[model samples]
Target: MTLVSTATLLQDAYARGTGVAALNVITLEQAEGTVLGAEQAGLPVILQVSENAAKFHLDDPGPLAAALAVLARTSQVDVSLHLDHVTRTTLLHRAAECGFSSVMFDAGPLPYEENVATTREAAWWGHEHGLLVEAELGYVGGKASQVESAHGDGVRTDPDQAREYVAETGVDALAVAVGSKHAMTTAEAELDLDLVARLREAVSVPLVLHGSSGVPQPTIAAAIRAGITKVNIGTITTIAFTRPIRQKLADLPALNDPRQYLEPARTSVSAVVAEMVATVGLAGTQRS
Candidate 1:
């Protein structure tokens, strides 16, 4: 298994009628863990770095992107490096130049016409560089650049607008808002299945479900059945990574070495990723 295009992963999932797991990677450890998780589960995965994570690394994600690219190349399972929820043209270009296989150009918060214009430009440029481009049609209720709000605040993606936006942007994938919120610690978000099915029937491109960390496992599988080909997950994996580290540090107060704790935390994250990959029906899949 070698590094593949993000489009390849999602397209394979769509062909197989399953969903691909896209996890956010914030650190070198997280990248390693994600690749290992996919390997352990024998699934193809998208390892993504969000705009916020890039800024956390001082807006220069070259080092992290390079690291993930290397891991993707060396990993035993199919992996892709992706830049998620990036709005700034400068950052978007930087990510493409840094060897990311794809990028999510978020313009969901912009006015309908402006979003189409900006996203279309990004899609054109991204394609020229042989990178897969994904754009959200409507807001998904999250942080800035991703969705521009928190808790979704009752913003839903209109099926008609979704059709028009996809036709206008020409993105490789379209993230639609049904009824999920970002950063939910609990898996209690109720999805509008009817709306999801309608959008699936209306939009030609593959659909992405944002704020998936809040959706229940069963509901995630249901979303996939209803036409969600890519599921973006973050908070839950971070929580899984952190919870173990907290426990380790509390149990051993004199843990001066970072590896002693981070190793276990990384393993925890890997297990979580593997579980999600299985839940999405991608485990043991070799199409990507």
Candidate 2:
């Protein structure tokens, strides 16, 4: 079989009541590290480049896009490139047109009606081009200065809104904030399992848990059991890889070449990915 479509793989995971980790990549190192992790785990990993990352590369998607495509083709495990948390129409279109298999249109800052309408329009664009659409729960919770909160400031998604949003927008997946905080340095972020369960009962499409890094492993596993089909993993990997690398550099003061230090970083990240994939029940489930 040719490369597996992210939509199909994610849907399968959703059906199996498991969550797939989507790692964010902003640099070649991040891409390499992520692919190495997946290769080590013997599983395909979703390679996501968020709007912020795209902007950092001079408002162009070419470099990151090209790198991921090359990695996807060469990597041992499947690698699906995705554009995450897009807000601008131009960038959203650019992402899909630039060769993303799927993209998330983050309308979490818009009014409920506007969020639905905009997402529907975006979803149509995605559908017309045979791309998967991932929409937010309209209650994006995080400390990102640029990201606006939509589910009414400080309040997370009420279960009813989730069902209505999915029905109205026809999105393939939904990102819900259930007490997990984004960009949190600590791994102590607690998740509201009750809210997650309510959302599971309320929405039919695959449920996405954002800010997932902050939540503990058991809580994340509990969320998987509670019907979360996708887990967005960034910060966890950040802490897992970075902290150790920093210590390594301090130990080896004369090492200038990246390979010397990054090797350990890659190894560390791969271990984390393997455990996470197993914990999320994605191991031994690679599709042909």
Clashing pairs in 1: none
Worst 10 residues of 1 by lDDT: 279-288
By TM-score, how accurate is candidate 2?
0.88
- What is candidate 2's local distance difference test score? 0.78
lDDT by residue (51-73, candidate 1, tens digit) is: 98999999899999988988988
lDDT comparing candidate 1 with the true structure: 0.86
Off by over 4 Å in 2: 145-154, 248-255, 282-288
Q: Return the number of clashes found in candidate 1.
A: 0
